[model samples]
Target chain A: MNRNRWLLLPLLLTLLFGFSLSLGSVRIPFGQILTILAGGDATEPVWADIVWNFRLTKALTCLLAGGGLALAGLQMQTLFRNALAGPDVLGLSAGASLAVALIFMGQAAGIRLLYEPSPWTTALVASGGCFAVVVIMLAIAQRLRDNVSLLLVGMMISAAVSSFVGILQFVSKAEEMQIYIVWTFGSLGSLNWPEIAVLTATLAAGTFLAIRSAKALNAWLLGQHYAQSLGVPIKRSRMIIILSTCILTGGVTAFCGPIGFVGLAVPHLVKLLIRTSDHKILIPASMAGGAALMLFCDVLAQLPGSTQVLPINAVTALIGAPVVIWVILRHPRMLP
Target chain B: MSPDTPTIALQTHALSTGYNNPVLHLLENMSLTLHAGELVCLMGPNGVGKSTLMRTLAGLQRPLAGSVTLEGGPGMPPEHQVAVVLTEKIAGVNMTVYELVTFGRYPYLDWNMRLREEDKKIIGQAISQTRIHGFTHKKLYELSDGQLQLVMIARALAQDTAVILLDEPTAHLDLNNRVEIMKLLQRLARETGKAILVATHELDLALQTADILWVAGKDKTLLTGLPEDLVLQGTLDEIFQLKGYDLKTGQIYHTAFRNKTVALHGEGYLYRWTRNALERNGYNIAASTPTDVTLTIEPGDRPAWQLRRGTATNLYYSLGELLKALPK
Candidate 1:
């Protein structure tokens, strides 16, 4: 079952990715997409720009953000032994959004910048917010003995950060508010080359760490005590899991503006389809599942043959929520 | 014929264990020994730190003061040397029985996590030892409590430890499964030559099955002895506060005596059972002192009970009819 589905995931990811590249308001032909991807001139010269500059970058962004967030969610669910735990559960995304909001609001309202800010500066500042939350969470994690309480504390932190973001939203000008609001809506087409490369590096590092801890993660399913008995160094493995999750979610939230649903929904969806809790199998499967789901949602977000594009966050929650609910209801063990 | 000298597998030297944060001491300065190839049951009242003691012995928690040693080394034993089965249930997991049993080899596995042919053989032996081969492919969520307990035991066996500590492995199991697991533990101890320590509340089962009994009471001490010796010395009774039940005669607790005393006369198995029936119905079976009523059991292919009340006498073929004829 795993072998067949393992092949199915990458296949789905590839198909959805290229299929999404061919879709848009102009609706480029599949042959033109192949020709443009193969470094040849398309029948229509404008097709290459739309494909390479807009659709191609957007598709790759979806893959990285989706796959990275999905793995983070999987790690959180296993670390906390919770069905609902995700990247957002720990408030890393919330933290990033809060920092981004503050940076946006401060620039226009008398908190002048010391230097010229690049597009990459936003990603870095957003990560500073994530690092702050991760530090505070790691400190609390040390004092707390169990995962259930840790999840509750994470939720509370998210709530507090959200309220802070709410305050920033309230006392802002129309233009500043629109910038923050559009960032919150989660865009995938905003990235240039350097941003994508940085996102790729973070995703690769996070994935590597996740794979290294796969053995410990499998033991974690038996729970902490049992995992300890099985010779899993509890503290070190715990630190690694949290760090990996933070890096993965932090990178995505910084670059993609807190895209919702893929992190929370993809692992459960993968587990439902793949039928194994072994992290050795689960991590890669979640990676593929997440990337495929994101590209599919991105295609829908494009709203083909229409000029207007829907928010990636809206398309994700609207599509991912019902599908997750259906999967959880049909196969109840998916949550656990 | 020579008598074999048993080797001690695990021992505690004046060990004191409790939580460190609050400076709470549960068991203080307690020394205990567990011999190899023995099934020892640690029986205690609730809140008397049986679990705390178990955790300390298994090295799950640190001892407050003194040390617990395995093979004369004072520290936590090697994971392969001391296997522990906690009371925590593995719930809603998609792991197969075989996969979990093989997980017992976790201590030996490196980052690769690939099991060798030898590890597979050990896992197979564990499954066969606990008789969980039938469900080797089944998911954990599909197993019953009895099956899951057996799987847990198999995992411990696969650990191939010198000592195995289980905290109430038979809890929430049916009577048949309880007996089956206890008997299996006894067999495993003898076969594997591992010291098995079970901390449980099943007094009756422990008394019947354990090679030695470790009874802990409110005084923070473990009184260890043979099962019969513990019962005879009144340690079990003292520890449990056996008020209504008689541990010596195996009598069930009954509230009503009703002041009705009968001199029951019989021999062997028939005599004990007749007394049980009479005693169960609020009738005191006197040993020697005679009352106006006397009941004698006539043992044969079809036994009969002869009941006498002063000059009036009645004979019933069965104890049931004789019980029915008694005055309410």
Candidate 2:
């Protein structure tokens, strides 16, 4: 069972990666996709662009975003020791959305803006917003000393930011409102190379920090006092967790919009499947699980054999919400 | 303090420990020492800074004033010497006993938390010593509260610290489990020669098992001595005596005013339980034969009690009916 648990994730992830590469709007044959991946030309040149450019990038983006967000969710869950804790639950995504809403809606309303509406500007603005929320949450975590209260405070910040965003949308231009709405729906296909580079770098740094803090996270499973008693530097560990979760979810939401539910549900699914809380295994397993699930979700969002693609965020929630509910029902004792 | 043991595992000097935001103080000017090979039980009323003191001593919380030091050589870390087993639910942690015990090696492991041969040997010894080797492969969630408590102790043992502190280790266990756990702690202390301090309300178990007692008193003071010494000095009663409970005798003192009197006779466990039942039912126990009602306990396979009231005799198998038949 242990060996199978270890192999199951990477195996599924590889299979899903292959499926994501081969099955999209223009279904490239599996052989051609492999051939194209190996530097050989396909029967049609469009197949190469479809498979290599669009499908391959989308798959990689899904992998990174999914893996990063899941790891962030795992850290949040462990940090708070709350079963329901997720990256977005702390209002970071709301902060990013608020930033995106401000720029997109500001442009639509013909308001004077300091910078042009570009991906880099949006990424920077989103990161700034994410950083702001993370700072507030960290401050609250220090003072509150209770996870539930901190969670509620996060919700309040999210609600407050969302209300402001509502105001921005109410007075915005129709075209700009449409742009903000589309961003909120989220997409994985729009990122070119530079945005992916930014995301990849952030993902690497965040995962590194998280993996380094695995021992501390395990200690935290017994609560903060137990962790501190075990020689874990509580304040330092909290800082690293906050910083890593911010960089990860912030970077992803910057590019893919607040891609929902993947962060919330993926970690729980991994834990349920693997049945271990050791972050040494959990961290990497969750990464792989998140990647596979996100690729699968991306495939669903693509609406195989159809031109009409659904919102990535909608697909995640549509799938994620039920799994969360089922997990809660099945493992009621695990929930606080 | 023992004359032969020169080294103190943990000591707190003039320490004031509490949360300061609201200016509430729990313990003040407390000085105590835990020596090697001694099992010490800390007793106090609820909300009496027992947990706080334990936390402060374990270095989980900073003291408001004064200092806590492990009496090893300089530059040795406090965590390297002290390990704590908290009562807090390890809740939702999905790991086997072996896995949970492995975390005890965390302080000694590298940043990657890879266990070396020495760590594994220590972990194995902890499991066996705690007598949890039978269920080493069992998930913690599957263990009963008593077993879980033992596993936490095992985890602490795995830390290989000189001092082990536990907060209410027997709080949620049954009578047999509680006594068993207390016995285990006592044996571990003597066997490993580690100083073990257990903060608990199990007065009976503490009286039986503790080599010394740390009593949190009413006046922001701490009383430390042998359990018998504390009892003789009335320090245990001063801290643990509640409205209707006596810590020294391990008996429930009934304050209920009874207008009736009953003289209980016979010997052994049956006589003791009969007296308990009579006291619980608002009957004043008399030193000699009563005016009318006299309860005689007879011990046997199907033992019965005879209640004689002015020559009107009644035989009852259970204490319940005998008490019910009493004159109101």
Candidate 1 residue lDDT tens string, B29-70: 888999899999998989888888887887777889998888
Cα displacement (Å) at residue A285, model 1: 1.0
- How much is the lDDT of residue B50 in candidate 2? 93
Q: For each candidate, what's the DockQ?
A: 0.53, 0.62
For A225-284, candidate 2 gives per-residue lDDT tens digits of 888888898888888987899999999999888998888799888987888878998899
| Candidate 2 docking classification | medium
TM-score, cand. 2: 0.91
Give the per-residue Cα lDDT of candidate 2 at A94. Answer: 97
Q: What's the DockQ of model 2? A: 0.62
Off by over 4 Å in 1: A1-6, A107-110, A113-118, A323-335, B1-5, B72-77, B287-289, B298-303, B308-318
